[model samples]
Target: MNYYSHNIGDYAQATTHLSLVEDAIYSRLLRRYYAEEEPIADNMTQICRWVGARTEEEKEATAQILTEYFQLHEGYWRNKRADAEIAAYHVKAETAKANGKRGGRPRKEAPFSEASYGGTAGNAGSSENPPETGSQANQEPGNKNQELKETSPSPPTRASGFDASTIDLPDWLDRDEWCSWIADRRARRKPVTQEAARRQLQQLAAYLAEGHQPGAVIANSIAGGYQGLYPPRVQARPGPSASRAQRLADWTDDLRDVLASDRHPREKFMGTIDATH
Candidate 1:
């Protein structure tokens, strides 16, 4: 008789579960004794008792064949079950549609053409007023919006639809200064410097001397620390240097005065500033 002739379940009962480990051991036994010819089919109870005595390590070695066999067989049933589910869905959809047609409940109407404002549809332009039922885009934002449409103008031209690119951007958005301003704000950060560190210490001392509250001390210390640590790498040219003179006369006291008055002297900048100062 063929070895392993009994069903896999009988062989599996040899172990608690047909665990891969049990199958491995059984296969090994098959190969060793029945290599040349089929081995006699062992009883399930006897096989279970025999497998129970064997180490799990021995069983795992023969598990591959059993694992592959079950995987292939199991996958077939899984696919069948999935196919059954799809068929059920199709039947249910058909039944629902039939019931809807029979008017079991109020069904949602398919959009064809709706009357203007909040009223029902009729022939085109049958009513002088805009459609009250459905708006141009068929958008129903809210009850207030529906009511408003009922009271307002007829379907608007397609041009009235929202397209940001078609919109007129605010004057500030088109200006280079606006972009530069944002860039400056983003550029504001801590300064990496020794002098700034010293100033930070000095500010802390001043705050303590002034007997300021802990919060104020922390706030001022942070600000002073940044100012001391980060020195502006680009120094302002004294009185606009020479090149500036070519474009707008010499850097006279008048120009220097203007620059200083307007904060070109070094007041205008980004970062943590002493607003109180």
Candidate 2:
């Protein structure tokens, strides 16, 4: 899989005791695991190299994190959480494939009723605009309007005819964001089918259960241009004083800027701010 969900709160809480380097190593290992959709290989040297752990400290951190977080199963190191995610991904993929083979979502046929038969009979005349008759003729204007609405043909069985507005949204879901997401899909020429929407909501509910905000989860998919919903990516939290990792990253960017501008690199060491104060 090219992508996987990363819960920032969960990761931050779990890695609170880890040093910056160890945290970095852990992140790289997770990326590899998700991309490969399999357990990390049991070879320590190869795993260290794959995650770019060159120094002794980095290598040791790599080994320590792997031992503490992953369980050695048979010949590979496995993470229970990662395994469960991969399994769920496969199940959803297979379901979508099967749905496609059946020519999109199954049509929801409106149940036939005597009222529907009456409506059909009302329209049976050859006239282009059939005259209202029977009960329709004797009803008040408001009642006539109601009868007309009830008699309208149900939406066609085609996928395009699925009305998203009629969807029964959950109370926890934000209505505006949901409508925006639907609009985004339609603008991309990828209309959401009823079944697809139902499945996405089900998945969204699971993410919500994990303490993810509904808006953030939906926004993640919209930003990524993803047709299916996914948990939001992890974001670094800000602090009054930058962490060592943040400082190093800022320093790297400043170095590049200094080089490009032909200024003394020492003029700004940690960030764009002048260092000579």
Candidate 3:
């Protein structure tokens, strides 16, 4: 598994209480888990060395994070979410390999419609059509009339360079919203090209993998008047009716833990709350 989906909302909610050191340790552990595609060894020393957790605080954070997020199996530590993602990756890989064996997807054929082409041949090449046989057709090959007609060129076309119609949007994306985004870009004098369109779709797909609604993510970019799509930021503004403690809790997950635990001294509690503000 070279890559795995990381849902920002889910991850933030789960680890919002972690310190910077804890966060770094956990990230490194998950990376090793995915790279090896196996459970972590049930050895703290090895785990600490693997993640380069040299200091006492770093080592303690590594242990704490492992205990909180992982389960101790027979002789290893296993994470349910990581295991599920690995299993899914394998299933997808096998499916793709099987599809390759079958020569990949077959292209869709256009539906037959005789009305589109029925009059084309008669209108273009038939001698029986009076419009074709009149004036120009009856003129001699080297005559002045033929020369004049041949010299008259068709009107030139003005190319817009970019074609919005060629973009093949995914089914999950709202067509109207996507069109509005394209229009917004054009109005801002920064029209989307084929390469830009592809990159945007890829970014949108990444957001989708992280459990973001396609409509909302696109709408956020449009609302912000941004040139590129971005993951929505978590707003921390509390309501006017909310208490100071509630607001602090929303701002810092560690503050919530401090406020909830009576084991900490009053001075420490006050210090934590004041530090966040």
Q: Across residues 1-277, which tens digit of lDDT does each residue of candidate 2 receive?
A: 9988788888889999999898888899988999999898899889989989999988999999999889998999988667656655664676577669878855665756544324455555544555677877666556756876887777675445776645666656778988888998898888888667767776766676566777897787788676777667564544667776787776676575456434667743344656699
TM-score per model over all chains: 0.14, 0.42, 0.40
| lDDT, model 2, position 209 | 53
Which ranges in model 2 have alpha carbons more than 4 Å from their true place? Answer: 106-277
Of the pair 1 and 3, which is ahead by lDDT?
3
Ranking of models by lDDT: 2, 3, 1
Clashing pairs in 3: none
Best by TM-score: 2
Candidate 3 C-alpha lDDT tens digits along 100-164: 88687555545434333224554544434344356675664347446556665655564457665
Every candidate's lDDT: 0.38, 0.75, 0.71
Q: What is the lDDT of candidate 1?
A: 0.38
Clashing residue pairs in candidate 2 (N, C-alpha, C atoms within 3 angstroms): none
- Specify the poorest-scoring 10-residue window by lDDT in model 3: 262-271
Task: Give the per-residue lDDT of model 1 (tens digit) for 1-277.
Answer: 1222234564455455555665555555444333333222333334434445355555443343334332234222112222222333333455456557757654454443354333465455565655556474355446656675566655544332222222222221232422332233235643223222223333333333233332443433234332221211223444433454443333343355445334344343222446797
